[model samples]
Target chain A: MEESPTIYEQIRTSGYSRRDFLKFCAWVTAFMGIEASGIGNVVRAMETKHRLPVVWFHFQECTCCSESFLRSSHPIVAEIILDKLSLAYTETLQAAAGYQAEEVLYNTMKKYKGEYLMLVEGSVPTDNDGVYCCIAGKTSLDIVKEAAEGAKAIISWGSCASNGCIQAANPNPTGATPIHKIIKNKPIINVPGCPPIGEVMAGVIVYLLTFDRIPELDGMGRPKAFYSRRIHDTCYRRPNYDAGLFVESFDDESARKGYCLYKMGCKGPVTYNACAVTKWNNGVSYPIKSGHPCIGCSEENFWDNGPFYQHLASFPGFGIETTADDIGLAVGAVTVAGIAAHAVRANIKKRKLINADIEESKKEGGE
Target chain B: MEDQKIKRVYVWEIPVRIYHWLNALVVVTLAVTGYLIGNPLAIQSSAEAYLGYWFGTVRFIHFVAAFIFFFNFLFRIYWGFAGNKYADWKNFIPYTKKYIRECYDVLKLDILHIKVKPFISVGHNALAGLTYFLTFLAFLFQSITGFGMYSAMSDSFFPKLFAWVVPFLGGDFAVRQWHHLMMWFFIIFAVVHVYIVFYHDYVERRGVLSSMAGGWKFIEKDKPT
Candidate 1:
């Protein structure tokens, strides 16, 4: 295999000072929740290890994952991260296009077979031979299967790739399927979110490059360092939730006071991500911090979970679409009414039976 | 002569009566607190957020009641095997042909109101026993969903065992929705159960309500049923 420039050498050639390179390492290491001692190791690894070749692919997605990755909280993301990786091919960022782009993809696969990382954005559509999404006349199913055949590990970049995002919501017409579902043999990491926090995307890539192995994963195959805890668990507004102080609506007085957004259909309690702690846009604020409920963008089938402003989800079955409370109340009321009617009829029947028994006893005594 | 002849039968033992009452209490506790945890009341106090821990207290009550309910259910399972014939396992499970017939007979008499003769059951009637068996399954459902959500907040091994249920059901939202709906099941069950007990009490004069409290039910000595 051809040797690639180390991250430090590439960064220096790209006009980044050595101090800037080390600073990026420390920032990413801290974001990964690694101890202070781990920062030095990260720097040493990046300075010596050759650039890891990556073949990033896009399928049925909104390109927001790429947007989030390139515009990570740090300024060096586009410069170092994109430039540092010996990126063989990426539809979004690669300078090549058309047939030339296709050639790069094949050459990288052939040259770095079993060595390069396969980073996927969005989901693959398999219905009708994967015609829903086609890149250069080849269906996503064909491309993904071909690309994933020899990769060491697959990093699914967002809810689109990890859990099929909006495309795989209820009544999915395209049969959009996530990466892990299709590529069963390879090690997969699911970084699920509408567009997972920018820093988190960077952290996942950094963790893999530094250690040359996948990070610890949760039951959902997400990196545990960032996806283990629910936003509610570490939320600054948790005290308000515990106190039963909640925003009833968008313009309510409770909302003005910055009480918990749970009553307004905030799904922080159910969604697992680093948004509450890591914040977004370089620690500026997250959805809850900005007066909007979480909407559970990070969880699977978040779009189908329910309305964005309702606390309860719309139960899926039974042709009638309604909240649990609506159905529960209706069923409960009907049952009570049935009981009332049954009690009235039962009482009448009991009285009639009792009078008949009394008459029979009197006749027996007279006889 | 038939109306004058009567027999007092020992139906429920002390253990069965205690289990019944305890289960009733636990169900009420769990349903109320579980509902509140899902749709908490907006009690905005003027005091600081830390000063009011009402929601936390509601959740704590739910957890405590849930544990009690789970253990109470387990105890009832044990009693189904060990208790007297009236409380035996055979009655709860409608396996035999006779038990299935009893269900039909009771349904005709109580619900259809077409059967003139009253169906007599020394213990729970087959239909009611069958309903209770279904309720037990609902009980198990609530426990599974309850523990699954609890696993996220707790590090204990007991709750951890149910962690698999979270992803299995598609995560926290689905589990909470299901658990909340089951609370309504218990509510409806309680309403119907109480009405049936009263209706039978008036018709039979067999002390159906008192039987639960005193372990005795009055039966007719002449009738074979």
Candidate 2:
């Protein structure tokens, strides 16, 4: 079997000039937040290294990750990245079906053992012996275990795979669990978003390919280069949040004027993601920019964190309509009422004791 | 009947009195600002976003109060080690059999409303000491979670030290929830603490409130030690 050409040769054959290929390398390097000095190194790595074989697996997911990846703004992302990388098996993108797809998966595993990358989308269902999500007559759990054993590193593509998005929300019927929970031994990198930005997905892949190692990850196994700061920090309307100018309602004047959506339960402050910086659909706009508050889809248990349109409040149903002042005032009133009642009881008890003392004194006098 | 004389016993040292008032101020500031941070007032300002900065000011006040609260609590801990017996760290632990007995006696007298003679201690009773110890732990938790959340925004090394606490406690949202809940704990503690102090002042006639102010607690000279 003739060895497949390097990504550079593939790019050259595809009629992209040497300049276009170096520009692609520099663009990916910039996305990875590598210093300008490392651009040549990135170029060298891309020119020399073979495209790593990626086995993309889908479980209980919305297929939004693949959709996002397909929509990458870069011209070569779909042409070069999707086509050039040896994507041996993917349910959504693969041309082969059934036995042929299974053959590719097994062949890739056997040939590139301890070398291929595993990209898991969505979460694996554990209930009823993983009956909820099955592929090719095998439970996703079984497939994940089999594939993860041979992969170099695993990338949990979305919140479903990273922190068990909506599938693993409250009363998770399927017992859907994130990849990291089941595959404990593997070096897992979590790129968590509802459907993480395409540029970020490419950035993660490029960083891995260039450095031959995973990017510096934060405590949650997310790449620090992208997920280190919160969306709130980089948001354009942050000054409004700092200034206490909030959108009171979805259709209010503040919303029209692009004030902060914090009062409307924007989870930007608590959610860590690169959405505000990278944006979505080719740096056009994110949820916050499009007159909607962040649902915090990237954070853990976001679906259970309460309603999307209401800020974090003690009471579930009384989030947007009721202010903390209302609760504080009510508590204050109750505290005062209790104090008053206690005071009245204490006063009556004191008076009774005083009366008893006088009666005892009078009885002594009579004696 | 013989006349009763009052002996003024210096219980709270200057450092303890200072710590008490400072802690009270810091706690109040922290609770108010912390509540505001969680549930910011919808201030409709006609001024530009940069000019208004009202929420930022609230956050700044909260952070400042948090630092003071943390350091004041630390100072109190140090005073517990270095100050007199009344301010001793040993009093807070309640490990000794006598301390445990005093705790039970105080609990009976206060909560159970039993007519048991109050366990007379020059400083905080065992129950109060234990409560204060728990409050200290709560203070530590709030600091960890608060700083942990702040670490994301701040570039300073002090706040960064607690960055791991957010991930350890699950995430930023959970950390905020726990931090907010702890604020209620402080508020409740303040209410109960104030009531108990006044009640003790009335019953024991030890000038509980004034002692906190002046560092002198008056005791009946003829009373048993």
Candidate 3:
């Protein structure tokens, strides 16, 4: 950590002006939802602060989070933080290999003890003695537990690391578990998505480095600045949802007209992410912008929620696939039928009892 | 009939009666709107999106009714403590051995048909009381899930209180599933509840069904020895 240059030194060496660095600081400050006064503090901290060491661990993941991070939307993110963070050891980006790579990872673990930030990219598989996912003969579960012990704090880079994304979906064969489930002591910031938006990924890191503390988190341990509002709240097609103008199918005219994808199971209503606002691929277009429904990748157990192509008419729960209305109509019909049967029997039985009482009264009166 | 004397008993108090009817209306409204929300009507119009706020209006009605339902439930809870002896809190819970026995007795008569007559209680029978208590628990569940989902849409502190439920229950989808399923619970409860009330009115010759409306139940007096 001490050997690396501060972010300010990196900018100075790159021949960028003080104004450029100030602008960068202000941009991150705004993303953090900090007041205008906080920009100065961010600048002061960045100029004096030593480059924080980061260890990015990849396990049962697709490396999309790394892709999103490297291709971050922010103009300065790819250039500044990428170079400034002093990535001590990352499986995907590092050039070293074999024992040399393993040696760097171990040395960083020792030298940066209680100081290095650990960014976990995926879940740790724990089934069958963690045989499902192994790296260099060590199970993900064992490696993560060992690596987590000396970390300053942990950042779950995507839904894979946050809530056991797809691998930990229903009937999870690998017994894949998220980092938080395995490491309880460290403060974890879960930036969840199939792959979180590039800007959001960059924002989390910038917030951590600038503030030297985790940002305000929501109940889900996600940064409140990005995850507090559902995608529906900020969606541009919101008027269409509110108007009930929806695309019934992908080939429908409404699809060309840009109607809301909600009817086609757009999970934008339930999904919390910066995708709607930030957009993907340098704010060019997102899946929703291209007429595809949001899959709610950021949410927990999203894969098991239901089919992505269908709306909320049905879901799998109660040990069977059924909907509320289907069960309601069936139970209602049966209950009415049963009641009709009960009424006839009850009336007939009551008549007999009443007549018997009348006869007994007559006998008593005659006596 | 000629040898019997009848007495009129005031069982349901005015507040309790009002709460009952209001709750029924709100529950019906909520169920209908809630179902539609889960499965939108798919009304396709060539008109611009601004021309129709049909779905928005439906949601507005639901939110308003939800607020009314929530407050009405709170009022009933207060009435349970403040109202007359028949509408007292003690009746809702099976607090004693006798209460449980009466529930079993009502079950035997109404359900098993082992007895030929209706179980008589000026207020709700023990079985109905206990069942209604369970629905109250369902009411709590629905409110939590309802407001929990609403928290995402609104920034109000009241709704925000239930925000933790989303993550706790896995997510919005799981919460919505439970909320939707519970709607059927109320509907089924209403079906059986109405039937039993009418069945009692017929069998017992008491104003059981009308008692909820007019607050009077005709009780047969002691027979001449």
Candidate 4:
């Protein structure tokens, strides 16, 4: 087959007008947090560069990442970006099956060796000879290592691929491990939501396509452009949080008024994601906007952190539903009971000593 | 009884007494407010969302107490260096052979409940001194983790100094867990500390409780200086 056309040619052939293309470029540039001056650079890159080949892999995940990516609200994002990308092989999206799919993946890896981008969407299990998750009779660990060796960079999509998600929660039976931990040599960028925002995913791809390099990453290797700030920092109900107003429960008046969900165990304060600033479903509303607390899905081991409905106080794995008050009250009761018991013992010991002293004095008086 | 002579030894200085009471107050404030901050009460208020700052007030009290606790701890450290021999930094550490011996003696008398003659000290008993040392270390841990969590929400330079601690310890969730756990440590320490002080006052007859308030401890004149 002839070499694939540049993104500009693909967009033009797809019936997108020049104005529409430039508008998309500007929109992506802004989404990438690039200044207005950088719009020309983004457009130029798109016009000149051929789409990069991506081998999307799945190990042990729910395919929510791909679902979220396909559901990108932007028309061009879903239509142009996903379609235009040289997605050589993806288990979920690829039409080929069995040997044909494996052949495509091998071909992409060989043809674009050290050039293709590897997008991993799930965690690789390391226990029991990696029998928990496998593809084509090859364990995920073997696949990830083999793919990562030749890829230019790896994009760990979603929490499963980033931090093991619920699969890596306490007592992880399969011993599921994230991609970054498995592949240490490659420059891995983690997009760590349960299902990262579709726009954010698109923005990361656009950034890589435009800049020809991975975006700036935070300490946890997430794109700083989107994951730099906590959800609470940009939450609309922050004023209510500062004023100590919170939703007491799901059906309460405060919930109707859309009060802050901090009291309802919102993990927004600790969770770093673009959900608050870039609301999901085409900026319609996010979890907090819908009067539900943030479950902190993007955070590492968030499932093991605590329950979704309770605050963070009852942490340290006492129980799923136990709150801080329960622990405190129990400890307080124990302390009181222990102290009372000690006090009673002390009183008995003192009385014994006094009686012994009285008996000794009486004997001395008789003598 | 009339012939018995008592010598009033000034062990805790005014600074030590002040630090003790202030530290106690700050610990109580931090425990209650910290618990409330961790697990806030569901206050059903008829007031507007903007008008109710109750939780914020609880957080404010916690932060303020944390600050006071931190600085008071710092002042105590300073006084430990500058204060008299009894309040010296050296007293807190069990470096010398004497301190170790005293520790054994006190353990035998108090915890072990042995009938051995108590070896009296002018200042803190070696065991008490060691316990205080451990509590001080716990205080430092709480300060670092507490300020680390606060750094995210605070704009202050001081709290920001501890900002690195959160990422260094993994994340805010872990830091909060540790900070909460340390609060319980303080509560347990307070209970044991107060009980031990009273127990020593009864058994040793050393005015251990009053000594913290008045800076003086009554020692038998015949006892070795």
| Candidate with maximal DockQ | 1
The sequence of per-residue lDDT tens digits that candidate 4 reaches over residues B23-56 is: 9998999999888777666666667767777778
The order by descending DockQ is: 1, 3, 2, 4
Give the higher-lDDT candidate: 1 or 4: 1
Estimate, for each residue in A6-26, the C-alpha lDDT of model 4 and write its tens digit: 889998999999999999888
Q: What is the alpha-carbon lDDT for the whole of candidate 1?
A: 0.88
Q: Which is the leading candidate under lDDT?
A: 1
**Cα-based lDDT at residue A20, candidate 1:** 89
lDDT of each: 0.88, 0.85, 0.86, 0.84
Note the DockQ of each predicted structure.
0.75, 0.51, 0.63, 0.42
Model 1 lDDT per residue over B181-206, tens place: 88888988998889889888877778
Residue A48, candidate 2: alpha-carbon lDDT: 78
Q: Residue B78 error for model 3, in Å?
A: 1.8
Tens digit per residue, CA lDDT, model 2, A1-367: 2277887888788899998888888887887888999998888877877878989999999989989988988877776557788788889888999899999999999999999999999999999999999998999999999999999999999999999999998689999999999999989999999898888899998888888898999999999988998899999999999999999988888888999999898999999999898899888999999999898888998887776777764444565445344565567678757666755654554555447757866996698
Of all native A–B interface contacts, model 3 reproduces a fraction of: 0.73
List where candidate 4 sits over 4 angstroms from the true fold.
A1-4, A313-320, A344-367, B1-4, B94-101, B155-158, B167-170
lDDT of 3 by residue, A102-160 (tens): 88888989989999999999998999999999887898888898989999999999999
Q: For model 4, what is the error of residue B92's alpha carbon versus the real structure, in angstroms, after optimal superposition?
A: 3.6
| C-alpha RMSD of each candidate structure in angstroms | 2.5, 3.6, 3.2, 4.0
